[model samples]
Structure formats: C-alpha cells, structure tokens
Target: MVREVLTVSERAPWWRAPAAVTAGALPCLAFPAPALWWFAYVALVPWILLLRSAPRGRRAALEGWLGGAGFVFAVHHWLLPSLHVFLFAVAALVGLLWIPWALLVRELLGGTPGPGRAAAALVLVPAGWLLSELARSWQGLGGPWGLLGASQWQVAPALRLASVGGVWLVGLLVVAVNCALVLLITAPAARSAALAGVTGCAVLTGAVWLWAPRPEPVGSLRVALVQPGLVPDSPDSPERRFDLGERLTGTLAGQRPDLVVWGESSVGADLAARPDLTRRLAELSARVGAPLLVNVDARGADRPGIRKSAVLVGPGGPTGERYDKMRLVPFGEYVPARALLGWATSVGKAAEENRVPGSAPVLMDLPGRPGVRLGPLVCFESAFPDMSRHLARGGAALLVDQSATSTFQDSWAPAQHASLSALRAAETGRPVVHATLTGISEVRGPSGGRIGPALSTAASTARVYEVPLARGTTLYVRFGDWPAGAALAALAVYCAAAGARAVRLRRPGPEPSAPPARTVRGSAGRRAR
Candidate 1:
C-alpha cells in the first residue's frame, strides 16, 4: 500500500516535473528585463529539486518530457498561430528528447557518477537541447525562435558566455548550474559544497558584472535604421516600400553617417538584378554620403536563383561582397525531408520551401573603412551561434542581422526573437546591428544589451545610430564550437563504456542454487528412517 501510494504520487499530474520546468522557464524572460535579470538563477532552483527526486528510466523520462513540454510550450506559446499545427507535431516528437534529459539530471545528482558516468550524464542534457534547437529551427519541424539561452540577452554576464562557446554552451552552463545547486542542497554540510555551490555562484555573478567587452571608439560610421510601415506580404506596393530606403537615407544624410542599414528582405528583389532600383539605391547612398547596407531577398542573380541572399551597395558600386544565409527556418524557408514528407507538407495552406540556404558566412567591407568587416546574418541565421562565431573568426568588426518578422505581426515574437542577438554580441564581444523588416531593429554591444535605438516597424521611422565597432576578437570567435562538441563526444564515449560494463555485470553470473536441504533431511532421516 505504501509502495502504491508512492508510485501514485510520483505519477500524479499536479506539481509534476512538467510544472517545475515550466515554472523555471517562464520566469527566465525576466532575463531581458533589467530589474528582473537575477531571476534566471533563481528560476532554476525548483527544476533542480524536481530533478533530484525523480526515479529512473520511464518515470524519469516522463518527468523530463513534461518538463520539456512545459518549458518550450510556455516560452514559445506566441508561435502557435504562425506554427500551430507544426508546434503540436514538434511538441509530440520532442518528448522523446526530454526523457533522457530528465534521466540525466537524476543520474548526475545520485553522486555515483565516475568520469564516464559523469560525462554520459552531463552530455545528455546539452546534446538533447542543441539537437532539439537544431531540429525545431529547421524548416520541417517548425522554425527557430526563443531558444533558452536567448532570454539572457538583457543580462550582461550571461551574455558573455554566448560569444565564447555559442548559445549552446550558455544553455549547457545554465543546466549545469541548476544541477550543481541541486547537488548542493542534498549533500550533508560540507565546506567545499558551500564554497563551490553558493560562494562560487556569488563570485561568478560578480565576474559577469565586471567582464563586459570593451567597445571600440566610434571613429567614423554613424548609421541609421529605417522602419517601414508597410507589412511583409504587402511589400510589393513600391510607393509604400520603395521610398523607405531612399527616405531613410535622405533623412540621415545630414548626420553624415558613413553607412545606412534597412531591415532584412527590405529589398524584395536583388538590387543587382534591378538596374533602375540599383540606380535609385546608389542615389540614396550618394545623397547620404555613405554606403547602404541593404538586406535583399529573392534568388541571387550571380548564383542564378540558387539561394536566398543579402548584399551591399554604394555610390561607387556594389561592394562585390555578399552573404548568403546558411541556417534557414525549416517550414518558413524550406520544407523538411520534402521528397519523403511533401505529401503532408501543407499545413493550413502554408506550403513550405520558400528559401534555400547559403553555403558560407559573408563578411562585407564597410565603405570608407577597408578593415571594418560587416558580419551578415539574415533573419534565421542569427539564431545559430556558430554563424556569427564563424564571421567573427574571419575578422568581422561588427555583426549585422537583417530580419523580417512580418509573419508574426501581432505577437511579441519580434521583441523576443530580437533579444537573442544581444547575447550573441556579448558572446563574441562584437557589436550587433539587428535591422528587421517590420519591427525591433536595434543595436547591441559585445555583451547583450540595447545600446542604440530599435526601429519600430509599426510606424515609418528611422534612427541614426553611432555604433562602436570594437577592434579586438574574442576567444569564442577563435575557437568556435569545437570545445563543446568535443566535450559532448567524450561524454558519449564515457557513457557507452559504463553501459557496457553494467551490461556485463548484469549478465547471468555462474549458476547458483547450491545444495541447501542436506542438513534438515539428515536430521529427519536419523530420527525417522
């Protein structure tokens, strides 16, 4: 009866792991809000406790599943309308992913983890998270927005981690910290536990406060971001959209900005293909006395309709530099496994495969500044930590993401998604200039925070920004994702070895059931033969 009661309580719906994880994730949005940024660390505690108490295997798996569903579902509830059906499908599929994460947390907390067990247990959570992020962001599953670490864009110290290891590492560390806290709570009073868990976190918080990337002096390039009133679907109305690039440039021309930026897909077709439009943009750049860093959509003329692309244009001519986006939002850009899954691809009449991916990261030369390279990330690419890291690796002075969030016009998706870029800047210690097609175009210093004005696509407006182009590179940019990937691989190997040993130990040992009845039988025989 006691066992039954315990089992029932474990499986009960109320206050389950799902609720804990959900609660933990929901409060993290406070990360982007200045007064509430500290909530991120506090938010993790409950989930950590829940992980500590979970049983193994199926129950642990289910607990984690619920936790994952709650976390993602709560954070991404805004995406339901744009990706409702897809969200449901993806939610169901990702349950498999969460189970192990829950189980891993349980294993790590048990204190039985050796190097192999520790690695195995540790790798599962982050690996699962990265894979899920990758899968969801892909076109077939749904699209990438609001990944967990992205919430910390407004927090300075947390953002620093992104530039170093990418957002995956940030997510990994957050999970690790939560696990550590759980360990700290369960252990008997030990000096090291308090020092490592409580004091370590305190010291780390201080490090975050002081370790911000130094900003470069704004020697020359004062820039402007234009927010057009026209929506994405209605962008075809040129009188409404065409005048934006020109008007914004002309308005900011007096400020003598060396460059002007419009939002992503702001130019419907490739400017190079449209000679008349190119001339008009050149005129705008000339009038502004700066090169225009324009975000172009449509098939590339040079690549012959091979990919969706972005390019640079100036009074002198096109900069001969362009960046094609590598990572694409799955359903938003291209259908997933289309050849195999196209039969079911149409959900609510939203046919997939709207865009193709670019092969490499493109760093454009800012006009008048030969060494100042613009790291270009168009819309979805901004979600990929490695994309920016790749550009930063190749001597990018500034990171620029051109985005169009017109699809989720009514939701807070623009603001939520845009916040992530700030963390990316912090991670790489490079400034990020995020210009959007509809709304929330803004600037972020190396550490994730709003440094300049963000254009509101809700109105026709423009803001000229003097962005500090930092000259130094970060360790994260130089190293890339190799460290984390290596760690994950090592973890996998360790887990495999331990699992093999467990299986061997469990293998039926030498046959037993030795002769046990001889003494009693001998006494009976002596008395009653």
Candidate 2:
C-alpha cells in the first residue's frame, strides 16, 4: 500500500485566522503606553509564518486582510467611544487595502517555496508594506498615525536614522528586521540568507549609532506648555475652557518663560474681532514677560469665513504674526465631498462649518526675541512630516504643535498623537513642543530625546522646559523623503523582474518524453490493426 503526502492546506489548522489577528495586534505593544519597543521586530513573524502555510494567492490575501483589520482595529480602538459600532466596520474596510499585500507575500513566500522566493520576500514584503503605509497617509484617507518606525521613537540609533533619512528609512530597517526574523522560521532552507540579512541590519544599526551626527546645542529657550484638561461631553461652556487655560497660564508668570503656548482652540473667538479678548491675552503675555501663542477657531472677524489660526500676542498688542493651519483633518476639519459624505457628521465629530485651511506654512517671529522663529502646527498638522519639513526649511528655530485630543483622551489617540513630536524633532533637527488641551504634552530635543516629563491626560497644569535648540539642518531636511523614493524605485524594478519570470514560466515547455509504443497504441485491438 502507498500513502500520499498531505499538502499544507490538507492539514490546515483551525487557528490560522485568530493567529493572524493576534500577530497583528501584538505590534501595538511596541507603541506608547505599553511601549515594548523590542517586540516590534518580532511582532510580524506569526503573520509571515501563517503566510508560509497559505496554499494559494487567494488564501494568503484573506489572511493578509484579516491581519490588516486586526492592526487597524487594535491601533485605533480608542476611537470606539466616539465612533462606536462603526469603528469595526471602518477597520474591516480599511483592511481591504492589505489584500494586495497578501497576494505579494504569497507570490514571494508560498508559491515557489525556494531560496530565490525566500530572498525576494525579505526585500519585497517590507517594500509592499511601506507602499501601503504611504497610500493610507493621504489626508483624505486616515493620515499616518501608527507608522512602524514611530515605534522606535525612543531608540537612539533609530532616531539617528530618522535624522539622516527621515522616518521612511527607519521604517524600512524595521520591516527588514521583521523579514529576517520571519525567514529564520518560515524558510529553514534559506538559513544562510536569513543570517546574512540579520547581520546586515545589525551592522547598519551600529554604523548609525557610531557615526550619526549629534545635535549641537545652541542657546536654550524657556517655553511653557499649558493643558486645560477639558472634556468634550462636559457641560462646561467653550468660554469656560478658555478661562481654565487663562488661569493655568497665569500661574506660569513667575517662571518668566520666553514663550507661552496653549492648546488648539483655547480661544474660541477671533482675536482680531474681539479686541477685548486680544487685550487680555496681550496683558497675559506682558505679565509672563513673553509672547503668548494662542490658537483660535472661529469665524474670521476681519474676513467673511471660518478658520483655525495660531496667533501671537505680545505686550505691545497682536504681533500680526500668524500661521493659519495648512493641513486640516479630513472628517474632523472638513468632510470630503461634503455633498456625498455629509452624513458622516451624524456618526462622529464632523465640523459644523468645514474649517478653511491656510495657503502655506508660516514661520512666525517670536516677539522681543530677535532671531528666534517659531513654526506652529495646528491640531492634525502634527501628523504630517512635510509640514514640519517645510517649516524647518523656512528657518524655524523651534517647532510647536498645538493639539486638542479632548475627544479621544481616554483612548490611545493622545499617546499616539503626542509621540509624533519625537519623530518630527529628529527629522528636522529642531526642538518640538506638543501642547495639548487635555494631556500627553511633550517636549523633544533635536535628537528626539524628551527634554522633560510629558504631562499625561490625568493632569491639568503647566510645565516649563529649557528646550535646547540646534543650529544647522539635518540631512533629512536637506533631502526630503529620499529613502522612500529609493524604495519606490526598487519596488518597480522588483515587480518588473517578477513579471518577466512569471511570463517565462508560463510559456510552453518542450513536449514531455515520447510515450512508449504500448501507450501510444492504446488498446490490444488497435495494435492488431
């Protein structure tokens, strides 16, 4: 009797989908709150292992989609309170974006099942992931929030890589490391290749640590960040929020900071129209012996429109220096195709009147501090790298993000939002202050190190940091997104090569060996004839 060998699917286990979901959720631990950074390297191994067992492209695609759903759901789970039941539907739909990723992984890992395919997976898997990340980063889509590299915000060597090549390079290295780990278990036949890949990553990390340029400290600026800790559902009026901020900021008058920053929409009225309110802020600036940077969300008093603006107040009066927020949050600031998606407002926090965006990034002058310039990123603008890069290129000495995570403070949103400052700081080689309404306020140095303790969501207070400034630009600011561009070029080449190989394989091969005479003659009657 002969026994047939079972294919991977013939022995398919029941645990595959759950396994993918679990693997997908594991990486969240690598981010803030739990912040087990080392786990990020190995987090994807389980998914890759599942991919190895996937029988065909279709199966792999399903697994990939499921894993993607898990990741989106886990990372943005904090949105549940606001988004409610709709959050899961949104996550599952967004997970559809990973269908192509599954197909690619299967083609490289599951189809050929050899060293060549294994090697391709190591390079192409991460490339595919980065491309997916880049696509979702579009503002109309959800912006870049939980990027893979941002998990390494606290890692010194990774921050150096960001200084050299922006977050794209760091994310590339992280995915490469994950690929290497996957290879060790999933492709035992390619052990040599896996070892080499891991070694290359280690060597590259060491090189960055040993040689990356250190941020040189120029003069320091004492800046105070105030949090009002207001909740959205509370019965407190908008004016009450302002009063709380005013009270919190008033206490810091004794510290005598060079600048005072309040969270987004701290001033509900347009200061230009409300001269009385502007005067109050100017007096506060005078009392603190510094300029007060306050964010305003209101109908344009001078012009006939609505806007979200960052205004500077000096002892003399309004400094006339302002940065209107350039990038607006898609659903939060404005509903995309309002005629079509206007219904979004019924589901979540959509703007009553879509806030108008600024024309370009503005670098505002710091009153009384000659040669000191501040770049203000309002609310969601902090999530974008180009905004920060643009500000840095415009000769901004300090970068400040005025944010309000009041709605999602109880969720992962505040922690995730606050962590972005470190990446921005590293990329631009400038100090960054994340001032928020509720909490998770932070100050990061040029090298991405925290200047002081971050104010968590539980606090309603003000803290001052003697922020160290840097003189020259980092290579990242000089050459923007070069690493991502290179990765794109490489991906194109890889796809072309893979296409050619598939065509060759599909082409007709030589006929099989000539059949024996008996087989060719078929039956005995035919042979007799």
Candidate 3:
C-alpha cells in the first residue's frame, strides 16, 4: 500500500484583511450625508480587484468578510450612540455573512481569464450580493437599511427600474454593473462583453421608463405632515409628545388639510383606553376639518400587550378602521429571544417591552374623500416592499409612513429612513408622505420625485404638502420581486454546476503502476529491470 501526501499552503498575510475592510467601507460614501450615489458604481471595484490576488476561496472569503465588516460598520455607525462600541462587533459579525459571497466572486472572477467566466461573474456576483442583502434584511436581523439599490433613491432611472422590479432589481443591476466594471479592469479581452453588459443595462433602463407603467394623477390631497421634533434628555412621557403634536396640529388648522398626519408614537396611550385623549384628537380633527391619523404606541387596550397602531380619528371620534404596524424593527421594537436579549434595554435602544406585530395591512378609507384610500405604514415598515405593495394592490390612493428617527436625528439614519419612502412610492405608484417626528420629512410623488422641500430636522413646524394622488398599481406591486427571485434561482443553478465541476476536478485518477523489483519477487533472482 502507498500513501499520498497533499501539502496545504499557509494563510494569506494579515495586511490583506485591512485592505478588504477599506474596500467595504468605500461603498458607504454612496449613501447619504455625503451621498455620492455614482460612487457605488466603482466602490466595490477595489474589493473585486483585491480578490484577484487571493490564492484560494478561503482567503477570498476572509478578505470579503473583512470588507463587509468595514462597509456595515461605516453604514450603521449611527448605532454607536445607542449600541456604543459594541456596534463595531455587530458590524464585523454581520460582515461574516459575506464570506460565501467572497468565495463565489473569487470562483467566478479570480482564477480564470475567460469571457465565459466574466459573463458568469456578471450574473452570479450580483445575485450573490442580493442574497446577502436579503439575508441581513430578515426580520430577525437588521431590516433592509443600507441596501445598495437604496443609494439610487434620487436617480430617476433607478426609480423607474424600482417600479418595474422593486429595489432588489435595482440592486441586482448595480451589482451587475460593478461586476462588469471589474471585468473591464481585470480582463482586457472581455472588454466587449463588459461594454455589452453596460449597454444592456442602459437599454433596460430606457425600456422601463418607456414601457413600464406610468402612474397618472387621479386626484390630489392637501396633507399636512406635523413634525413636533424631539429633545434629548426629555422625560419618557408620551403626554409631552402628544401635547407637542397637538400644538403642531393647531398651527395647521388654517391650512385645513384634507388629512392631518402625525409621526409614529406621537401619542403614547391607546385611544381606546383613554377617552379623554381620543376626544381631544377628535376635536382637533373637527377643528382642522380633516380626519386626524394619530399613531399610538402603548399597552393594548383590548389585548394583553403593547401595540403600535395608527388610529383614525374623524370629527365623530375613533373610526373603526385602524392599522397596526406589521413590521417591527429588530431590537428597537422587540428583541429576538427576549429571554436572552432583554438586558439590551439597559445598554442600548432596545425597547423594554416588545410591541405586538399586526396581522395584515389595512387600507384606510378617507373620511370625506370618496374613492380614495390611505395606505399607512408605521416607521420601519416603509422599508418593506410587501407591506406597501399589498396596500396598493388593495386600492390605496396614496401611501403614508409615520416614522420617527428622532433618536438618530443627527445621524445618517434619519436621512436614510426618509429616503425609503421615495422607493416605496415609486414601487407602489402612489404618492407617499414620510411624516416624521424630527425633521427629514419628505413627500414623494408617485414617480418618486420630491414633491416639495423636505422638512429639515432643525425645526419643529407644520408643512402642508399638495400630495398628488396616483391611482393604479406598479408592475412591482403586481408581480412582486420577480427579478430577485429569478436571480436567486439562476445563481443556485450556476453554483450547483460549479460545485459539480469542482468535485470532478478533485476526483483522483488511476495511480501510476509500481516498477517491478526482481529481488522482492524471487529471492534468488537477479535484480529485475
């Protein structure tokens, strides 16, 4: 019997680790505050280039993980105010999820130099990235906050693409463009394929704008977004918040808006339990001559626990229609496995009590406006496509999000949170009012264009927006995330094929025959040749 020995190489140097991290962080510039949305096109170029030097999949994945850590930390740095130094650790951990993405990228782009590989890299890399984004956006983890597609919130072409295929599609195109750029830089022979890829994307964008469903204004609403603002060190009193909201509402009385919208948790007590508060809101509604939609975050009046609800208050008082927030922000609203993470409140922004999630999206019928319905999403729920899509499908004439990024007022979070509404509006083909507690409030038309100047976080005031209502559903609302789904499926098939090929390459072939030895075969025989 013979034994075969295989020697494995040592790991790559430690310096490459930081290089990966730096590459990852570069993409953060593509987001808000210093939002260079165009930077996203080349942001990941360095990371892909770095992978070209990796000797194996493990090294590629390690570098990828480091880069992801950098990106995540930079993007979510605002969490430091609440999460403290622990935010870096969370970012690094989340970055580890990109290990597989690194391996996939290296396999498709690193080793070989061929047009076929370049083509595969273009499709698979983006698909893999979308998958990673999908994983992080799961309800248990952080919701989809820094999605690459989101960086294009202000881009008209991207908005049109989002309307056709949701943000996921936009992200796919972005990643595909990144991959094409990588191929363009690394493989000169594949330049034509890369150019073709770029041209195809341009064509797709044009097609979406030309052929995609365009939302037409069916009616309009005079809506007022009341931002009461917030002050740090303020007592944890919902009454104070409610009072502030009332004052803001009073200022809007002369405007006589069709609807009065307040930010999330503007009223802390459940209106059902507090008749006095309910009546006060109803009176405000009567005074304003419009239905007042107040967000109540408190212990459920009829149920056992807390609920974040949007209760409609007509001049007559609490209308039967109410919408509870379906999507709850992880750790913010409720921690996963409360028994273990319940202590988070002592250190960070985690809420003490978990707010119950609502069952279904409710399309609220406007009090006096017939044939018009308001789709309400609470806070982080606006980041989700399905919630708004369902409402749009149910015939919502407009969309409204009650959000408060007050705690992160100075951070990029407020800006990022506010930007999600534009995508949602475009995707659903309905005007969206992103009414918030502390500034960055914006109104986006059905086509995802800014309606008017955004309410800055620097002031507490009431601004009435002429929100143009669009009646109809976008293809994204009708077909859902079909592009992302197709990308996922295609990537799965590609990975399976690659995996089988790797197995074939690793399988051992027939061993060479041993030379004959006469002395071993016959003791007395001469040495055999």
User: Which sections of candidate 3 miss by over 4 Å?
Assistant: 1-11, 506-529
lDDT score, candidate 3, position 333: 82
Query: Could you give candidate 2's per-residue lDDT for residues 1-529 as a string of tens digits?
Result: 1122134434557687788777777788899878888988988777877776687666677678889889888988887776666567767877777777677777776633567766777778878888877877888777887888889888988888998888888888888888877777667787678788789888988888787777788899999999988645554566788888888888997897999999998888888778888888888888888888999988987776778888888987878888888778767788778898777678876666687889978889887688989999987888788889989999999999999988876777888888899999999999999999998899999888999899989999988899998888788999999977887887899889879999999999998998677645568869788
My TM-score estimates for the predictions, one after another, are 0.81, 0.90, 0.92
lDDT of 1 at 296: 70
The Cα local distance difference test for each model comes to: 0.65, 0.83, 0.85
User: Least accurate stretch of 10 residues (summed lDDT) in model 1?
Assistant: 188-197
Q: Pick the TM-score winner.
A: 3
For residues 366-473, write the lDDT of model 3, one tens digit per residue. 988988899899999888887888889889888889998888888898888888998998899999999998878989999999998999888788889998987667
User: In candidate 1, what are the lDDT values of residues 387-412, reduced to their tens digit?
Assistant: 77778878888888888778776666
What TM-score does candidate 2 get on C-alpha atoms?
0.90
Report how far residue 454 has shifted in candidate 2, in Å: 1.6
Show pairs that collide, candidate 1. 138-330, 139-330, 139-331, 162-427, 163-427, 163-428, 425-446, 426-446, 426-447
Residue 203 CA error for candidate 3 (Å)?
1.6
Q: Which pairs, if any, clash in model 2?
A: none
Residue range with the least summed lDDT across 10 consecutive positions in model 3: 1-10
